[model samples]
Target: MKIDENVCWGIIGCGDVTELKSGPAFQKVEDSSLVAVMRRNEEKVKDFAERHHVKKWTTNASEIINDKSINAIYIATPPSTHLQYALQVLKANKNVYLEKPMVLNSIEAKILSDALKQSRSKLTIAHYRRVLPVFLTVKELLESNVIGHVSLAEITIHQSKSANLIAKIADNWRTNPTISGGGYFHDIGPHQIDLMVHYFGEVDTIIAVDLEKNTVSNDVVKGFVQFKNGIQFKGNWDFNAEEDKDNCTIYGMKGTISFSFYGDEIIIFLKGKQERYQFKNPMHVQQPMIEKTVGYFLGKNVNPCSIHEAAVVTQIMDVFCGIN
Candidate 1:
């Protein structure tokens, strides 16, 4: 297959995330351009295009997928539409930058997997946290044995009904199971799960439970993950909690390291001493991953995150929510 020399990009869902987290980075990356953007709302999409300096805007996704000038398509739509739009892009022979929680469920992932077998187009999941400096530092510490013989990881992600951590969206589709696949956990858990698998290894077994299942969405969940490498993970997520708290701590034989997934600092404790590492996120938090994705689409680097790896996250969440 001939590699595309430059990645002319098109965005399928130019929503709030695109405003600063991702849309601008496409223009900032070398050999990449944000040529077009699409949203169901013509006014919003046109406004986004004008503000971002993109030349084209549309309400129809087919325009972006079928545009020959666009070698890569970024699909940031909700989880329910990921599989459909991704299949269309692949059929058009265009590379895809798919958002995380890759599909509504594992069944959709199976369908996407089958479609991928017949297409030469490449697809990368947006588990963007993998490329962040704070996460990279955590990986480095584990590799360097800064926290020796790591045995366990404990997580707490408690938030009230109106926590600021949850993205503000109209109609709150993120909390609707039919649209987001699960609940708030489904919306944000993919990154946490992906990071764990990235740092520890493949999952060996999963035991989880949710407080409610008959409702429109399940908000409270408890899960335990046992990685093949002997590292264990225990977590609790309560969207109806009274306060907001986000923390993850890894315990090891020599010491312990703790940090918040949404924060910019890592604290380490050992031998009666403590060390803290801080980081500042870029204006476009997703730029690092987008740059890597552009290189990957142009045949310069490997995929930042693959569909198969991302499926594990959905699969794990399925068990956590008792949907598997």
Candidate 2:
């Protein structure tokens, strides 16, 4: 693929994620340039633009979307605003790189999907796990049948409340159902679910046991999903736990594959031996996502997670949230 060397980029929201990691990634990616940024807070927008050396900053999101100079727009805002912002950008004929849990519900997902179909602009969701080296290795190993005929898989994610920034924000968007859809599950579960579907193919059925009282989310949740390939998966998310563990184990007839998110490494046990694979440091996984998304937009590659896959994920999450 020939690099265009002239891809101008704009960030829709200058939030913590953009400032800490994604902003730098956009600037660092080859053939990509961060030209503009938008935020509701004028001072924050100006500060971010100055700090990042962006050419333009505005509080009006439409300015970035409608700007003919910008070829791609990154929607780093919350899930609730994703659909609207994406549609507006698509309408303006700008490529979109949206954050995960693409929208609050499947309906919004469909709306965005339909808009993308009509517009010349392309869409890519921020499922960063797909581009991570360790996870990519896992995908390769599974494809190679290292774990012959995966039968069952389990994923457990535990995090301390002390580290939860969303919990500390007064009237945080993440806690509000209108903004974030649900709580922890909707916020972070998309990564796990997307990875599961990415490896195992489409899910045939899903049954969720959400323990929260007000339809937000519980400290613990257990879900069972059956994939079309007859692979059964059990997933759990525990937010109120003291010790943190983010790992997934896939079992098969021949061997097993295990991975830890914190370590960014994979462990494989096969044929009476165990081996480990470690990924590179300064693991800016988002860079790959940005590159691929740009490729997809420029008709160089396919959108890895299509609307159908995103809709399936939304359906499963809705069932988990007990939303009809």
Candidate 3:
């Protein structure tokens, strides 16, 4: 079922990711507008509303969720609050644009899945990169077999403890396992893993282990994914490394394709020739996905990213962190 109406949005957490990455896209998308925003900090929320030209701001999340005018709610809060707020939004008959790692664990994913089944509203996970041009091009190249019969893939992300790649928050909740799930792996792995699942199909088996354990979170995580398509993927994430490095390479019978998940360039190598492709992300990185989401919300198109697709990523992270 579709809304058949303009998508009026209420932001549940107006934090760093919303400043430019996604907040403005709600208004920029056709037939969609950000009507209100909510944050625990009254001052910050008010400031954000005034600066963004939004009409309403609140310190209470319920105010935004219960607002009759808000037909959709974007939950940008940490992983811990995702289930509570998402359940409430669905119960209120409001559509949801949930942030990634959809839930902390498979248990929460199941609970949310059940709620979605009983609700009339729709939910889309924020695995926004799949819609970006660079990734789409990579998907196309792989589909065309530009890299021949794919056999193996490697994903390596090594960053120093103070890596700028890691978003800095006041409370540092991202490193808190109870809040962000595992650690840097849980926070960043979903984006890469979701793309893997998007590029490949489903997972056949997965095995992961933590290399360095800390009270807050794991500093290093290594995992292997075996896809049913007969492709094997090995991934390693190190938060306490000597330097910063981010790249994923897919090897095939003919050559290989290498690219960075957070960057705009894609490179393909075949024998002696090397081809490069570059893309410029929109000023608002999430705008493209937001446009797609708006279209899906109004029944103009199919869901871009579904809860089930995102649940698979969470399940992978669970294994990576030795949760089960």
Candidate 4:
């Protein structure tokens, strides 16, 4: 089915993410409107619909999927249900915008791959950093050779020790492998892997080290990734660390470039000179990408995040976690 002049949207599992970073932005985009929202909690769904001024709310997935008014569906649920919801939407002839950590394992990712191969419907993942202003600048600098030929890069993501301690309680979905796929690594690793893959090509696994957290979580994960172009990536994600930081640094012939994944600060060092750049995030962080998705639905350009690009990250995580 072709996109209509207006891209009406329906959202599934309208949770915390839909509250700030994504929901309102759907209506703010030109030629796009949030027509329907769904969640298991009837009260929450009604509240979200009223707050966002969305026209419809429901507790059943099929209601929105069958609604001819909605041409696109956003799956905002946990990783466990992403594939299940996405297949129904696609089979109903609607485009999809999925939250990251695309699916729990490579097997799920492959099912999505095979489904897309036989359908004309489109899909985009929520790797929003792909279009953020600061990241776009970093991409520009890398392409312009701000740091000669890139050789080695290092990345670290650390959270205060107490964060996990607080989350280890009963029924915390973030720590449950059945629901979250893994702990903080599976949850936050997608952003890092997707961004790295955006700059370089596919990654080959060198080695991965895993450490246990309380029975609920895998607190520490470190790995070495090598790109076909010979660039080396060394990364560590520790949720039980003493400090809270998210940083990535790239080393090259001329100098080094450093920045944070969730922060606005970016620094470049070259030829005895150091330059720093800072910016604020948009009120709704996903607005830019949402606008782009609206454009794609309208056939204005190619999708921002393709299934193939997203699958690579999932494949890497599956291998790293030994999910096979």
Candidate 5:
């Protein structure tokens, strides 16, 4: 573990997500380079490496894991394969960057947690929102009492069944419980919960939650959760809703703040003086977090996000999904 010239990156699963949501950031960020990439499809790997200008590409993950030049491994595969690839990356004595919802449930989380504890390499999760400028600005706003002392919080995420990323799956791998570990609820639920943890604290209790699934619509989940701060909260995630929406409202003693989960705008309603602040995310949304990870490995900063943090996301999600 030497603080050397630059951090080299090896990406596993150079598929859809890697195209622009993250691929270019390895090179776009300062002092980090995507030296290698791997995918199950040879044609896709070749195209990704060539398009991203990565020096090497391979169909086998072992090639990326074993390459001496690759000091960091980015696991961009599905949730089911996160733990497996993470273990392999750690076993190779390289730092690991894992996808969100670390695993299916608390059971799988414990397995990955134990492996991380045993490994010599460092580990981080891709809760990219934690590094997004919009979220960070909101954190500052809350801390500065922009909305006064915060107390109650409410979240509502509803959308049409067939218009989302998961809906586009060909073989429909995203909704298949066996391959994706759950339906769209489990797939897209992590980003929301993980960000809540960042704003509030650990989820203390899932008071009560209900899950409804049907053939013609997106599944619906309704639940109430309490954070460590005793913040009373209620949230609903319904893919079956007729209206499309993504929103979270935090009510303070003085006022309220509302914003969308995947958008770049925040609205503050303080004393009826409404204000809106907007910030655009980078083309590669993961770049800021990836930059922080590179800095962590270079020994310049603390770890940004951890497997345990993502484990908490899965842990809470399991309760809402009635898994545990």
Candidate 6:
């Protein structure tokens, strides 16, 4: 069977993520090629192009969006800038691989959803966790009924500091309620919430508490969501923790599944037998996301995480942040 030609990729906001991280993955995926990159700083864009062996570089985001040769665009810009850039790319009729949290709230999420529907441009959110090997294994195990009926789940992500490069990029935008939508809850909650909704189903109700305010507003948030299946998911994010923790525990009638985000390893204890499973990190997590998203855009026989699911996650997050 003859394979279709690789899809040419253009990256908007070529920063640290594009260079040390996702940029390399774009080149690594078999059916995808990094053709062009854009950054406001010409020096950064040039350096990225040279390091990645990309043929084209531009300081203008629109240049990449408008290039007929580029079939897909990745928006790695800050959450604050996601909406405008995404709209421009959609107008240009290019598939979009958007960074996580989709957008600030349901309104922006709705706007982007409408744009995708109207333009019929392929859209995929970069909720990389959904594509991780361990997480995928957990999903499969849950569906396979090794755990019987899932009754409750707890997901916790504890980071020592909130002030990182991405946080700095989002500094002004993150603090401002107008731009960021909310703080850590809006930023990182999408990942955990996506997993919860994916495993369970629609959320019926949610209650949240945010304990901080500032540029990195909401240092901590704890909330519970009731899924349509009557399963309860309790999630917590503590930006002020001393050590980082990214793990989830699911409880069911027959067993429990526990896993961490960093290692892509899962442990299942069912009816007294303990089983541990491990899988290689697929494309460093983020790259597989890009590749799968590209395949979805190219009409290949691969399924990308649904934007409607992401929007629901965002909606749950909005409620968790008390935004609406």
Each candidate structure's TM-score, on Cα atoms with residue i matched to residue i, is 0.96, 0.92, 0.96, 0.94, 0.94, 0.89
Candidate 1, residues 1-324: lDDT per residue as tens digits? 122678888999999889989999999998888889999998889898888888999999998988878888999998999999999999998989999789998899999988988999988998999999899999998899997999999889999977898887767889888889878888888899899888887999998755353244767888899999899998888888999999999999999999999999999998869999999888899999999998888789998898888888888888888876
Q: After superposition, how far is residue 195 of candidate 4 from its true place, in Å?
A: 0.2
Query: Which of the two, 1 or 4, has more lDDT?
Result: 1
Query: By lDDT, who's the top model here?
Result: 3
User: lDDT score, residue 60, model 1?
Assistant: 95
Model 5 Cα lDDT, one tens digit per residue, 53-151: 888999999999999888898898887888788888888889988887687679989988898788889988888888898889888888898877788
lDDT digits (tens) for residues 251-295 of candidate 2: 989999999755667889999999998887354558887777766
lDDT value for candidate 2? 0.81
Count: clashes, candidate 6: 0
Candidate 6 local distance difference test against the native: 0.79
RMSD (Cα, Å) for all candidates, in order, is 1.9, 2.6, 1.9, 2.6, 2.2, 3.2
Show pairs that collide, candidate 5: none
Stronger candidate by TM-score (1 vs 2) = 1
Q: Identify the runs in model 6 with alpha carbons over 4 angstroms from their true place.
A: 1-5, 162-180, 209-216, 242-244
| Cand. 1 TM to true fold | 0.96
Candidate 5 ranges beyond 4 A from true positions: 1-3, 165-167, 212-218
Q: Give me the runs in candidate 1 sitting further than 4 Å from their true place.
A: 1-3, 210-216
lDDT of each: 0.88, 0.81, 0.90, 0.85, 0.82, 0.79
Q: Which has the higher lDDT value, candidate number 3 or candidate number 6?
A: 3
lDDT comparing candidate 3 with the true structure: 0.90
Q: Model 1: how far is 139 from its true place, Å?
A: 0.5
